[model samples]
Target chain A: MRAAYRPGPDAGVTVSDDGMSVYVARLPGGPLLVLDGAAALIWAEATTAPATGWVARVAELVGQPEDAITADVRAFVADLSARELLVPLGGDADPPTRA
Target chain B: MATQEATGAPSAGATVPLEVRIGFAHASVQWIADRCGADLLHVKGAALDPTLVPGRGYSDADVLARPAHVRRLLDELPRHGWELINTFVYGSSFEHSATLRHQDFGLLDLHRIYPGTGPTPERAFDTLWSQRTTKVLGGIDCPVPSHDAQAVVLLLHAARGGSDAKAANDVEWLWTSADDAARDRVLDWVGRLDAGLAFSVITGTLDEHRDDPAYDLWRVAARGGTRMEEWRARVRAARGLRAKLTVASRSVLVNVEHLTIVRGRPVSRAEIVAEFFGRPARGLREQVSRLARRSRR
Candidate 1:
């Protein structure tokens, strides 16, 4: 699954070693934070799925209530998107820092 | 590989040093304050830190403002010739400047709110913000915050960032500079605000890493050195465990005080280092020897 990681300047998306989880940091603050294990798994799927209905897909895999999982996934993307961390796959946003 | 030699843990027996990086920092900040036309407050422990490290306290400078002025300062960064770094999420909010380097004087820090910012039981702003309590530096008049205020902030900075040897000196200066009444006021304020949290952290460091060479460095007076690997480990571990908690816990606090009361004898750097690493470096060889269970992850 795709997730954005800013190791230095540019943001790149890649599947995590664990394969299930993804890590993302937004701007306004360069390094927001880190989360591991299951949460990372969900995050990776949401950021990378390349479909409008990825939220529903994520719910099925994580084995949680569908509506709750969908809402949470949406909220996570909204935050990263608001912080300008992620773009809508093909489109871009504000000036990316040096990267 | 971590040792007292690398971390530059201040020796406990050396009385105090005469110069500190904080001195230049203070000077540079003062330069900024005068330029901004903001009222400057006397930062108590910075002067005393020099006594311990010979040149450490020179790096500190502080000023107080009504909460509203901070917004104006942020908006005017470009005009003032400073770049706005991230607004700090802990203690009181402050900004960082990438440009204010003084020639060998020290880095300057301009503060808006004192960490844990509040007047203590024995002090009010009037007493500390007095006209007479200032040291004339580049020729501008400034008021000093009470010693108690300075001490408390120092402790929080050490706990917040954990590498400020400067803050540790401020803890020691509670005894060196202020009277017993002021010290009690600081301790009382600390207890009132977050005794459980502070005690948990301070004692946690003390219990786990007190015997490492880093701890030993502060126990004896010796010239200090940088322990980059050890420092990095502490930063990584502290961030791993406390990173999320740091922003959330400090969300509601008023201005951050950057100093604290210097109580009795100072805790050793080895202790601070050990606490940061979650174990004493000195005993790692032995601890590694006792791999009773080869549990694989």
Candidate 2:
């Protein structure tokens, strides 16, 4: 089964000066960046209105295919986790219950 | 008119041996700079947005040692100070610690470039070096990276320290401060790293600045995975908790706290310490226990 991307509690963020700071944080140790500004568009779409499968919906936001959003979401979450920014959701192991 | 200066002064020259950086940990840098006398003529790091002032802001302390004195300065000063901390891979030579109580009081980073570079890649440093300007620092000739390089370098450094460091929040100012051309030039520089795992990490960072009308660099960072628009909400949330942050100890139970006033409300320092470890304040209990122990002693 394909891993369905689930959005966590981490807030959507946007850098004003753009994505020059792609993966790395603002200065020393911070969050990851796509540098393509994908985080910006998704941040807007997902912020005010909460949704399920928010990651896969990114493509729709950027005028790309839904598959593209899913792919990018996987990559973004993977990168964020590697940098210690996002905590793992522990898929399949734990059943999802509405918080 | 003739005048006489006060005789009591801080010691000159480095107080400890120089240590090399394994990756980006700065604690080693601070430990050594303390013992070594840091004249602190000029400290550079992060960006110099037209609105941003040099020599101000919540800055990470950096110190410069004369090239001629570099070898000798790093060689001596081990006995005077005890070990404060060391990184995962501390270069045998570079040892960081805090020694002085003025200016760079809390954590001092010893470096050839004090608080130098924005959080930029090595290539960014090369770009900075390419356009370096020679300046006399502490009575010696020194070449400093251009403001553009400085800005990028500061951002990269902030990225390395994670969300815990104060200077990292300077990204909030970058969009609100720098011009489009300057911001675009930086995005172009970072665009070079778009096709790797590193690019994916740029998402959260890019989202932080998605709304700037000034430049589209966030678009560049979005290519990795996350788009700038996706981060708008997080940016708003981050702005709420940005300033008041701290990583108090290096122990396994790392203490994180927010220390600044956000939106006119101050972040309670004690609450922050507790929040850092997911528990309520135990400081008062600990304080009482310590007092009891002292009474018995």
Candidate 3:
């Protein structure tokens, strides 16, 4: 099972009301990052729960086969994790309860 | 800190929106204040509760720090890319807020006092802080004055806003058309904050406060005044012999920081000398014209 993700402790995130863009910044200072297009789609799915098939959800949103986009999505998530803007929840940590 | 600029954009050439930048500015300051253990209330601009006036636009972020915490916040702001462009003493007639600029977040006004409030800053902060609530800005839960207190603060801002269309519009929506209960709540805050002197401008009872020390300050602010009148009013409003002297002295000095911004670079000493001499002549011209107009009337 893949680890779920959540915004990092210092991350300040705002998704536009239209859901077309996600603005993220590191607090105490910033170089604000705007994520849109496929990046926005990936962020939306990665932070939502049932982390099991999160990459597949991204693929579904972009209307591409899961296998084709899986490697790229992982790379993007890793980049965000390295920047400390997103954190991978431990396997034992509770998946956010769905509404 | 993950605050470093991203070297690559996921999508090419996507510029951050102005409001988004402002939101990040709020988040940046809140983070700084938290680290410094300072108390601040995000007010006006982006922090304002949107329901108060729908579609009201704002260009920058404004935050009010507890009076005692202001110096500490100022000391810490620069470490986070918040450059102090204008100190409070030169900020305005009230000397209330310092202007800071950030590389990614545009402009911010860090207020030590929310002009028109107070018999004193400490008491005024306590009154507002006691009823504070939180609002999310830049995805961080930020403290803000309560709904009713916000109404009072907004009205006070409009009261000194002179003939600014936006200020008048704020008054029309937040005061003129507000129901009696809303008015009562705002009045209660005004009394608690001891903001009656300035609030009188909104009530159109400004002439009644002629004897007040700060009366000319508010009068000049609300009705507009020539540069000479403004300095005279500032001198009159300053509390003590020392403070009045300070205001009077500053009225004659050139603001180097403002000059730098206007010129978009560090100014030369020669330029400073030129402006120093030029300002008094300009102030005198304005004063003379105003006097002539008054006599003609």
TM-score of each: 0.34, 0.31, 0.94
The candidate 1 chain B region of ten consecutive residues with least summed lDDT is: B1-10
Residue-wise lDDT of candidate 1 within B1-297, one digit each (tens)? 000111123341121122222333343344445556644554544533233334443433444443444455444433433443324442222221122223222233445544333343123233335422565332223455444545554554444334456555644554346577866786675665433333233334433545332232221112222333333323332334475355334332222122111222345656444444543343354345434333432
Q: Write the per-residue lDDT of candidate 2 for residues A1-99, one digit (tens) a residue.
A: 223233333312223344321122211211223233565454333322234455445566667766545544555556545544344434421113322
Q: With candidate 3 superimposed using the best TM-score fit, by how many Å does residue B278's alpha carbon deviate from the native?
A: 0.9
Best by lDDT: 3
- What is the iRMS for every candidate structure? 17.6, 21.6, 5.1
Candidate 2 Cα RMSD (Å) = 28.1
- For model 2 the local lDDT of residue B270 reads 69
Model 3 RMSD in Å is: 4.1
**Stretches > 4 Å off in candidate 2:** A1-99, B1-55, B58-73, B76-108, B111-127, B136-140, B160-169, B191-297
Query: Quick one: best DockQ, which candidate?
Result: 3
- Identify the superior model by TM-score, candidate 1 or candidate 3: 3
Give the i-RMS of model 2 in Å: 21.6
DockQ, per model, reads 0.01, 0.01, 0.43
User: lDDT scores for all predictions?
Assistant: 0.39, 0.35, 0.86
Off by over 4 Å in 1: A1-99, B1-37, B40-55, B58-65, B89-106, B117-132, B161-183, B188-297
iRMS of candidate 3, Å? 5.1
